[model samples]
Target: MPDPSTLTPVDRSGGVRMADVSQKSDSARTAVAFGRIHLGEEAFQRVRDHDINKGDVLTTAQIAGIMGAKETSKLIPLCHDVMINGVEVDFTFNEEKEAIDIRAFTKSFGVTGVEMEALTAVSVAALTIYDMCKSVTKDIRIGDVHLRAKTGGQSGNWKSEVSAEEPAQN
Candidate 1:
């Protein structure tokens, strides 16, 4: 007989499965994720001046990010359909790096953490920026997608080790 106790995210039958959180107590969970989209000079200028033909690029991306966060379970396999309590997408234009930094904060009171939701938000926001600005420049690049911080759950609190050497953007 296969030992069910040793199975994790997969059964002895070799089928992927979602983790059962039925026994876990509901708790307040939050996650913060970050990503960056590098835009060419022209595209960056257009985004900064709200000159993109696709409407307000940043605002549109922000909206898309929130929607994405709510739909994370639908997009990613094995993710639980969590009821997100809040989602916030913020952006920072780094002229020095010719990139726009995207940050997503997600909160939920559930059995599972909201890290996937936060990551999905940042990823979708970066993609939306690329889609909106592709007409101006094809040199767009998305990178540095990672979890910046997270709290709650059995893991407790965590934070990224990235240094705070960069100047704050308005």
Candidate 2:
């Protein structure tokens, strides 16, 4: 293994450094992240049937996902703050597992990838689901959170190795 010192710091001056976006041209960037909250059948039915006392769980979660994306930098240290062009949150019901699948897509025209933002959105949204459904299903477990894809920047484009079992969705 190589010595850790062999790798140069982002800034040789040893001072805190933001990415050097000055030289890079602005380009459209996007990222997708996935997450799931496994719920008991009773809780799933409440969400599926719009019977939750808090109203629509899916809608609430979707909005939470977007807000989470915007507040990513605040939630995760070391993440850069960037203007978000757009964010989309999709929710799907899995009858077999009695769970809610969450996918967050975020876009921006900036120097940094939205990977953290995408992931944060799904995580917060999953937590929101648990908060809303805890009354009926205290055992709900958040699971399978991962990035699906990202695009733009100097590296061009990138797509995550998402499995066929949970294909990327709109």
Best by TM-score: 1
Tens-place lDDT digits, model 1, residues 87-109: 99999998987889998999999
Provide backbone clash counts, one per model.
0, 0
Give every collision pair in model 1. Answer: none
lDDT of 2 at 123: 93
Candidate that would win on lDDT: 1
Per-residue error for 62 in candidate 2, Å, reads 1.1
Q: Cα miss at 69, model 1 (Å)?
A: 0.2
Model 1 global lDDT (CA atoms, 0 to 1)? 0.91
Model 2, 54-170: lDDT tens digits are 878888988998999999989876578979999999888888788888999999998777888899899989999898999986989998998888899888777777676674674
